[model samples]
Target: MKPRLLLTLATVLGFSAGTVQADTIGDPVRGEQLFKRDCAACHQLGEGAVNRVGPQLNGVFDRRAGSLASFSYSKGMSRMGADGLTWTLETLDAYLANPRSLVSGTRMSYRGMKEQQDRSALMAYLRTWSDKPQNIPEASPTARPTVPELDPKILAIQGDPAYGEYLSSECTTCHQRDGSDQGIPAITRWPQDDFVAAMHAYKQKLRPHPVMQMMASRLTDEEIASLAAYFAALD
Candidate 1:
């Protein structure tokens, strides 16, 4: 679906957070399927869920955005939480339809799910993991990761750290030289393959951040390899 269509659909659904109903909606079974297909790579749910690329979805209902102490959220998401953005049914619906429309600089890699039914199903599945009055043991069937693997040839590229240092002047503006996460997450000390994969995701527009996409789009393959090498070596 076109980006504009997704944004428009988000608006048309029209469930304001202030007046949202907490009642369960949609089929959980179908929601499970949708979650496995689209969400398993980044988010985990049910009991004992831990942080992955994204925060665990457990207890997300009515939770403030970026509230997890363990997960490193984007500046945008943290700011939203500080401004009282809670994840109610309406807000989730809007976010699912168009993520960037809700949190512009969010690092969530997946493009938003555009179909309303699909979004409803996914949210329903996620809601099963939320805290409830009844003491129910959490259980979620394991699902395989859905992130696409990179080509072996791409992974084999050798990089020059000196060239990477030359390129890194642009990167260090947002990412700290001292490896502390100020507002942006720390990029220093990442493994080369993982760094390459993430940059490729942005370059291919598989990830949703516009600024990242723009930056990655202009870089040649070797430059990305060099940047990965340089960052990986940082103490």
Candidate 2:
């Protein structure tokens, strides 16, 4: 390559890289403004409010899902808690973009923030609550045993377990037997309602997880409910 051309190319590359880096570094001040406007309706800021529509945002940044004492989380959130997933900035960004996409059946009714700037702002705002450095939890080292106790919920309505099993065949690619995978986590022992909500989320595009999006897109509401029942019934 010619010296002048090489230098010009290098300069362009450097500028592009710098711009990308700048974009990812969220502004906490802007984030706070966005939070108050968008998220404050459901979530309370600071440590003062005990509980509101949603759990208090105080210390929520590093907290695990469903860890709040006061709020009643959906089964999906509870499952996330049991699995030990924490709310880091990156995770929060993704969740804020689409709640169901992150945890499948979370009961967070708010639609996602479509803009990247909005998501980044939300993440920055959430960071103010946590005292410690934030990190997401690793998958459980031990394999999860299927809980037979949950069968009643899954089998509550008349449906064929055989059909449920057949329908669930599609989920095995991502959910896996053990539930540990990249982006995709384990679903064993998940709450029945949460499972239902997750499918609903996907069907509605409220949850935008790619594989679940595709799968949920394919199934009817009844099919989703049936699959939820079957998974809940699995031991």
How many collisions per candidate? Answer: 0, 3
lDDT of 2 by residue, 154-187 (tens): 3345445577789877788768756566776777
Question: Model 2: what TM-score?
Answer: 0.46
Candidate 2: where is the Cα deviation over 4 Å?
1-24, 132-235
Q: Which ten residues in a row have the lowest lDDT in candidate 2?
A: 139-148
lDDT of 1 by residue, 1-235 (tens): 2545654796998767697433346678999999989988989888799999999999898789999999999999999999999987788889898898998898986688988888878877887788663553332212212232344454466989999999999889888977999778898999999989999899899999988897887676778999999999987
**Judged by lDDT against the true structure, how good is candidate 2?**
0.69
Query: Model-by-model lDDT, in order?
Result: 0.81, 0.69
lDDT of 1 at 135: 53
TM-scores for every predicted model: 0.47, 0.46
